[model samples]
Target chain A: MFKKVLVANRGEIAVRIIRACRDLGLKTAAVFSEADRQSLHAALADEGVCLAGFKPADTYLNMDKILRAARETGAQAIHPGYGYLAENEKFAARCREEGFVFIGPSPENIRLAGNKLMAREMAAAAGVPVIPGSARGVVSRDEALAIAAETGYPVMIKASAGGGGRGMRICSGPEELKEEFSIARAEAAAAFGNDTLYIERYLQNPRHIEFQILGDSSGRVVHLGDRECSVQRRYQKLLEEAPSPALDGVLREKMGAAALKVAQSMNYFNAGTVEFILDEKKNFYFMEINSRIQVEHPVTEMVTGIDLVKEQIRLSAGECLDYDFSSVPGRGWAIECRINAEDPENSFLPSPGTVERYRPPGGFGVRLDTHVYQGYSIPPYYDSLLAKLIAWGPDRKSAISVMSRALREFVIEPVKTTIPLHRRMLADKSFADGDYDTGFVRKFIPVDEDED
Target chain B: MAESPKRLEIRAPIAGVFYRRPSPEDPPYVEVGDTVKKKQVLCLLETMKVFQKIKSPADGKVVEIVARNEDPVADGGLLMVLETD
Candidate 1:
C-alpha cells in the first residue's frame, strides 16, 4: 500500500477521496485553488498545496501544477476524484511518467473509451449489443437510406463532432431522411467544421442504467451491479438508484455479463462504469463508458458494501482481485438525490450563497457526502452540487419512504435547493411506482410560467 | 487646473479571471498612462473557457489599472480608471 496519496480535485468528491485514503491508513495531500483556501478537503488532508489560481484552467485542470504538488507532498500516488483530469488520458500518462501511480484506468483505456464511435465499435466487436445503426459514418444519401431502411423508421442523424443537440436531426421516414440529410450536413459543417455524420436507431424514453465494474491489473473484472440514473435534467443526472425497478433477475444477469464483457475486451482496470440504454421491452444497448468513479457511485456502494475508491487504489497498486462476485447479488435497495444549490421553482437556476444555518438528516440507512458547512461561502467558480444524500433499505418501498423522511429532516437556510422538488417527486404516484423513464423530470416539473 | 478631472471607472461585465494579454506569451493590451481609442480592446475576462473581450467604453488615457493581471475579479469589479476626453 502507498503511504501517501495526492488528491487533485476539490469540493465534496475531494473530501470523499480524502476520507477513503484516511480509512486505508494513507496520508493524504490535497490541492486547492486560491478560492478554496477554506475548503473542507484541504483542511482534512495531512498536507495541502494551493495551485494559486481561482479558475479551473489554472488550478485543477493544470497538469503541471498538480504534478508539482504531488512531488512537493512526497506522495506516491495521485487520485483524480472525478471531472477535471479524472478521465484525461494525458494526465494519467503524465503521472505514470512522473513515477506516481494514477489510481484509475490506463491511458490507453481512457483514450479508447473517450471516443464514442470507437467505443461503440469496440463493444460491438466484443459481441456486446450496441444500438442497431451504421457501423461508421454514412458517406452518401444512398448509404444513409439503406442503413435507415434496415434500422427501420425514426432514425437519428448525428454530427460526428456535435454536442448540445446541434447538428442533430431525427428522420421519421425515407422522405424525411432525404430532406434532412443535406441540411444536417450543412449544419454540421457550419457548427463543427466537419460534415461527417452517423445514423442510429432512436430509442424512445429509454432508462439510463449503468453497471459498476472493478478490475485488477491481471485482467480480472467483476461487476458490482446496476444503477438506474433515469431521472435527469438536461442530460445531467439528478437522482440515481441501485437494482433498477425495470430489471428482473434474468435481465440483470444478462446486462451484468455484457458490462463485464465490455471491460474484459478492453482489458480495462480500476473503477469504471459501463452505461447502457434499456428500451421499454428491457432490450439493452451499449451507450458509452465513463472512465472514472461517477457521482452516484454511493448508491452501488450502499448495496454492495464496497468502497470503490479504496478498491481503485488497491487495483492501481497491482493487487489481485480478492472478492468473489460469482453469486454476490447485492443487498437491499439504495437511492440517491443530488442536492444541488439551485432553485427548482425558478428553472433550476444556480443559487450560490452562504448557508446561514445547516441541519442535516441522520439515522440508519441515511448518508450524506458533502463538504458544506454553515458559513462556507458557495463559490460560483465551480459546479452547484452542494451534497449527495443517499438512502438505503431492505426493499425499494422502504428506501423511498426513508428518502422522503430524510428529505424532510434535511435543511439549509437562505440558499435555495431542489429539496422541494425531490419531495414532490416522492409524493407523485408515477415516481413512487417506478413508472417513469428518462423523460420523467421534464414532464414532472412543470415549465416555469413566467418564461417568455 | 484648480478642479480635478472626473475619472471614469471601467467595471467588469462578468465574474472571471482577468487577463491583460490575449495569450500568456503576448504583450498586454494596454498599460497605465497609455492613450486608448474608443471601443479598443483593453483586456479579457475569462469564465469557464469563454473569453469576453473588455473594450474601452470611451476614448481616454489609462489613469489607473485596479485589477492585476491574472487576478479573479467579480462582476462589476473595478478593472481600470480612465481620464476621458
Candidate 2:
C-alpha cells in the first residue's frame, strides 16, 4: 500500500478521498486554491499545500503546481477526486511518468472514453446496444440529411466534442436539419474548436441510468448495480438513487452484465460509470462513459457498503478485489440529494457567500458529505455544491421518506440553496412514486418569485 | 493651488492571493512614492499556481498600499491607492 497520496482536487470530493485514505492508514496531502484557504479538505488532510491563486487555471487545473506539491509532500500517488484533472489523460500520463501512481484507469482508457464518437463505436464493437445514427462525423449537409433519413426524424445534431448541452441542435424535419446544420457546425467550432458534428436519433423522455463498475489491474471487474439519475435540470443531476425504480431483477441483471462487458472491452480499471439512456418502452441505449469516480457515487456506496475511494486506491496499488460479485447484492435503496448553493427561485443563479448558520441533519440511515461549516466562506471560483445528503432504507419508499425528512431538518442560512426546490420535489406525487424523468424537475418545480 | 491629485484605488480584478513581487526572492514590484506608467506591471496575483500581472491602469504615484504581501483578496478588493499626475 502507498504510504501517502495527494488529493488533487477540492471541495467535498477531496474531503471524501482524504477520509478514505486515512481509513486505509495512508497519509493524505491536499491542494487548495487561495479562495479555499480555510476549506475543510485542507484542514482534514495530513498536509495541505496552497496553489497560491483563486482561478481554476492557476489552482486545481495547474498540473505543474499539483505535481510539484505532490513531490514536495513525498506523496506516492495522486487521487484526482473527479472533475478537474480526474479524466484528463495527459495529467494521468504525467503522474505515471513522474513516478507517482495515478489512482484511476489507464490513460488510454480515459482517452477512449473522453471522445463521445469513439466511445459509441467501442460500445457497438463490444455488442452493447448503441443509439442508431451516423457511424462517423457528418461533414456535409447531404451526408447529414441522408443519415437523418435513415435514422428517422427528430434526430439530434451533436458536436463530436460537446457536453453539458452545448454545441447541439435537435432537428425535427429536413427543413430544420438544413437550417440547423450550419448553426451547429459554427457553434461546435466556437465551443470546442472543432466543427465535427454527428447525428443521433433523440429518444424522448429517456431515464438516465448508469452502472458503477469496479475493475482491478488484473482484469477482474464487478458491477455495483444501477443508479437512476433521471432527476435532473439541464443535464445536471440533482438527485440520484440506487436500485433504479425503473428496473426489475431480470432487467437489472441484463444491464449489469452489459455494463461489465463495457468495462471488460476497454480493460478499464478503477471506478468508472457506464451511462445508458433507458426509453419509455424499456429499451436501453449506450449514452457515454464517465471515466472517473463520479459526484453521485455515494448513493451506490450507501447501498453496496463499499468504499469506492478506498477501492480506487487499492486497485491502483495492485490489489485484487476481495469480494465476490454474486454475493454482494446491493442491500436496501439509497438516495442522494446534491445540495448546491444556488437560488432556485432566481433561475438557479449561484449564491456564494458565508454560511452564517449551518445545521445538518442526522439520524440512522442518513449521511452527510460536506466541506462547509458555520462561517465558512463559499467562494465564487469553483462549483457551488455545498453538500451531499444521502439516505438509505430497507426499501425505496422508506428511503424517500427518510430523505424528505432529512432535507426538512437540514438548515443552511444567509446564502440561498436548492433545499426549497428539493423539499418541493420530495413532496411531489410523481417524485414520491418514483415516476419522474429528467424533465420532471423543470416542469414540476414552481418558480415562485416570492420565495426568494 | 492645483486641484488635489485625483486619488484612484487599484482593485483586484479576480479573487486570489496578492504578491508584491514576481517571486519571493525578488524585490517588491513597486513601493510607496514610486511613479508608475500606465499598463506597467505593479504586482502579481497568484491563484491555482498561475501568476497574473496586476498592472497600473493609469500613470500614477503610489500613495498607499492597502493590501500587504500574500494577502487573500476578493474581486474588486482594494490593493493600493494611487495619485494620478
Candidate 3:
C-alpha cells in the first residue's frame, strides 16, 4: 500500500478518494485551488497543497503544479476522480514518466477510448454494436449532407473531441444541419482545441446506458453490471441507476461482455466506464468510454458492495485479479440523484449562493457525498453540482420510494435546486414504468419559469 | 419597494469570489453614478481561481451595488443594478 496518495481532483471525488485512502490506512494529500482552501476535501486530508489560483487550468489541470505538489508531499500515487484531467492521456503519461502512478487507466487506453472518433472505429473493429455513422471526420457541407441522407434525416453532427453537449448539434434536416454543423465545429474547437467533426444517426429517444469495468495490472478485466443514465440535461447526466429497469439478464451479460471486450481491446486498466446508447428497441450502440471514476459510481457501489477506489489503488500497486466476474453478485436496485446548484424553476439555470441552512437526509439506504455546508457559499467558477443523494433497496420500486422520501427530507434553503425535477421524476408514471427515454426531463419537466 | 429600474446586475457565469478592482490599489471601474456601456467591464468573478470579467449586459447608469465588495456571488446574485434608458 502507498504511504501517501495525492488526489489530483477536487470536490466530492477528492473527499471520496481521501476517505478511501484513510480506510486502507494510507495517508492522503489533497490538491486544491485557491478557491478551495476552506473546502472539506482539503481539511480532511493529512496534507493539502494549493496548486494555483481558482481556475481549473491553473489549479487542477496544471500538470507541473500537481506534480510539484505530489513530489512535495511525497505521494507515490495520483488519483484523478473523474472530470478535469481524469481521462487526460497526456497527464496520465506524465504521471507515469514522473514515477508517480496514476490511479486510472493507462495513457494508451485513454488515448484509444477517450477520443470519440477513435473509440467508434475501435468498437466497430471489435464487432461491438455501434451507431451507424461516417467512418472519419466530416469536412464539407456536401459530405455531411450525403452522410445525413444515408444515416437518415435526424443525424447528429458532433465534434469528435468533447462530449458534454458543447460540441454536439442535433440536426433534424439539412438546413438545421448546415447551421448546427458550423456552430458545433467552432464550439468544439474552442472547448477541446479540436476542429474535427463527425456524423451519426441520432437514435430517437435513446437511453444512456453504461457499464462499469475494472481491471488489474496483470491483464485481468471484469464488468460490474450496467447503469441507466438517461436522465440528463445538456448531455451531462443528472440521475443514474444500477440494474437498469430497461435491460434484462440477457442484455446485462451481453453489454457487460462487450464492455470488457472493449477495455481488453484497448488494454484498459484500473476503473473505466463504457457508455452506450440504447435505442427504444433495446438495441445498444457504443457511444464513448469515460476513462475515469464516474460521478454516479455510488449507485454501482451500493449494488455490488465493491469498494472501487480501493480496488483502483490496489491494482495500481501491482495487485493481480483478486476476483473474477462473479466475485460480487450485485443484488437489488440502486438510484442516485445528483443535487446540483441549479434552479429548476428558471429553465434549470445554475444557482450559486451561500447555504444558510443545510440538512441532508439520514436513514436506511441513503448516502450523501458532498462538501457544501450551511454558510458555505457555492463558488461561481466551478460546476454547479453540490452533492449526490444515492439510495439502495431490495428492488427498483423500493429504491425509488426511498429516494423520493430522502429527497423530500434533504434540504438546502435560499438557493433553488433540481430537487423539484427529481421529485417530479420519481412520481412520474413513465419513470415508474421505465418507459421514458432521455427526453424524459425536457418533455415532462419544463425548465422555463413560466411553466413552473 | 422597487426603485426606478436603475440596477445593473453583473451576474457570475460560474461560482466563486467577487473581486472589486483589477488590483486593490487600482481604481474601481464604476462608481455609484458612472455611466457604462454594454461591454464595459464592471467587476471580476473569481471562481476556482479563474477571474472571469462580468461586463455590463446593457447600457445604463450605475445606480447601486447590492453585493458587498470581495463578497461571494451565487449564479444569479445581483452584482450592481444599473438604471438604463
Poorest 10 consecutive residues of model 3 chain A by lDDT? A443-452
**Per-residue CA lDDT of candidate 1, range A281-388, in tens?**
888999788889999999999998988988998898888887755666689999999998877886676666678999999899999999998898776678778899
Per-candidate RMSD, Å: 5.7, 7.4, 5.0
Write the number of the candidate with greater lDDT, choosing between 1 and 2: 2
Give per-residue lDDT, candidate 2, residue A54: 75
Give the TM-score comparing model 1 with the true structure, all chains together: 0.83
Over 4 Å off in model 1, which ranges?
A139-146, A158-197, A448-452, B1-85
Cα lDDT, model 3, residue A281? 76
Model 1 residue B35 lDDT score: 94
Could you give the CAPRI-style class of model 1? incorrect
- Model 3, stretches more than 4 Å misplaced? A447-452, B1-85
Q: Tell me which residue pairs clash in candidate 1.
A: none
lDDT of 2 by residue, A1-452 (tens): 88999999999999999999999999999999977899999999999999988778789999999999999999999999888999899999999999999999899989888777888888889999998999998999999999999999999998877754566788999999999999899878877778889999988778999999899888988888899999987678999999899999889988888888888998888999999999999989988888999999999999888999999999999999877457788899999999998777765656667899999999989999999899998887688799999999999999989999999999999888988888888888988788878888887555644331
Once model 1 is optimally superposed onto the true structure by TM-score, how far is the C-alpha of residue B43 displaced, in angstroms?
A: 14
Per-residue lDDT for A327-440 in model 3, tens only? Answer: 788788999999988776666666666789999897998989998777887766677788999998899899999999999998998888888788988998989998777888
Residue A19 accuracy (lDDT) in model 1: 95
lDDT of 1: 0.88
DockQ for model 1 equals 0.10
